[model samples]
Target: MSLLFLLVAWSATVLSCALLCRAALAAARALPPAPEAAGDIAPDPAAADRHASGLTLYEMAYLSGGPHRLADVVLVLMAQKRRLLLADTGWATVVDPVGTDAVERAALTAIGPEGQRHIPAVRDALVGDAAVRRVADRLETQGLAQPAAVRPGIGGAVRLVKGSALVTLLSAVATYWTAAPGADSGQVLIWFTVPQILTLGLWAVARFELHPYSDWATVAGERRLPATTGSRDAPDAPGTPPGSLITLALRGPTALTDPSLRAALHSSGA
Candidate 1:
């Protein structure tokens, strides 16, 4: 019975290890080279121009932080333009019935024709909004973001390996409990060390090498992230500087320089 337990543990460990390796390879193949790795090459002028010009602010927000971030950007921009009211208490009231872009239009639709809704509800609604989906689709089409289907593949593999590790540990305990009375249970437990070591070692390496495997951006999109890391004290108000919103998109709500803006953002969904 002890030997049988060892066999089962070994089989699971080996299978999981193989799966881990395969997942890592698949993830590596799916991703383009790291952004910095391509620095030596010259960019195509027309392609670079399109890349710079075609990407809108809302799309940048999505690339930085997905749907919620895009929603935040729209809200902040609208508030600045006096088209919407973002109360410090987390309520959003639309002032202007018109929207400047698809994302803003979606936000308006989420708020309903009455022009009032809680900010959190708007953020949640935007997640499944067609405007957000279009942004994701366009990014994927341009090879600037990973497909939603492939994003979870490596993460799922990592979780499976973690489960396999737990099984190996339990099997070790079972081997000791099921051993013949005269047999050295410690020695039987020693057999489990092989699988345990295999699982743990691979887990550690995978954690290091594939840490950001589930992130939204592809290498190209990541490379295009704004360079501004805004100050907490930057005091950025709407229409103050273009980089202010970009900073908010990249760094999240914490980067909001206005106290009311910060409060509104945190109270909404922090």
Candidate 2:
């Protein structure tokens, strides 16, 4: 009867692990299809001069940087217009008293008291600000961003399921050894390994299946955005590309060489 109980626990845990994976996959599938960008930003010639085949700065940022790229957006925007200064100390200085828009206002407000405020401090303040959130949503609606996880509760559920598997495996092993004083427990302990193996396998599937949707850029954007790293001369342009201002959303001041342009793109530096 004790051996039978161990088998049942092992089988049930494995089955539950499989169900957890299946449910997660099914939930991922149930999410709405990736919506087309489709006039979500209402194109204006003055507000935008389209390139990268008509994608916006925000779109390019999404492509290169993910949703967290909003920090770059604020930094680049203020730096470009000479409203703020990023110093080597990872602190920001407000040069201009005003912000031109909601995103700008939110960023400016994020740097409280504005005397060389720390970078991480500013990021924490701005990261969850509602205005910043609105812009992020706009990028998503434009289809520049992948659909966000509509159901984010899977993470905790995953942890719980994994915990249950671990516990059941331990319990089975202990019960087996306790039931017999002289008998070897080696064969009974085989069941102990089953839950651990199943947990790893199911987690792998979930990682692969769910990653694409949760990322900020769609598959296309990730490929389309320039692959340049920091402070590198853009191979094609002299001085800087006018569109480089737009690129600032993803690349920051890295590509700019002109002292004025670099100053404008600066978020933080030595």
Tell me, by TM-score, which candidate is best.
Answer: 1
**Deviating ranges (above 4 Å) for candidate 1:** 1-55, 159-186, 204-209, 227-243
Q: What lDDT score goes with residue 258 in model 1?
A: 85
Candidate 2 structure quality by residue, lDDT tens digits, 1-270 = 457757766675666676566646655464446655546555533234445446655556655555446566666567768898766546778999687766677778888764557666676677688775665566556544545563333544466566766766666766675877787777767766676567766666655644333245544444344543222233432454544555565555564454654553343431
Residue pairs whose backbone atoms clash in candidate 2:
37-142, 79-264, 80-264, 88-269, 231-254
Best lDDT goes to which candidate?
Answer: 1
Residue 178 displacement in candidate 2 (angstroms)? 11
TM per prediction: 0.66, 0.54
Least well predicted 10-residue stretch by lDDT in candidate 2: 228-237
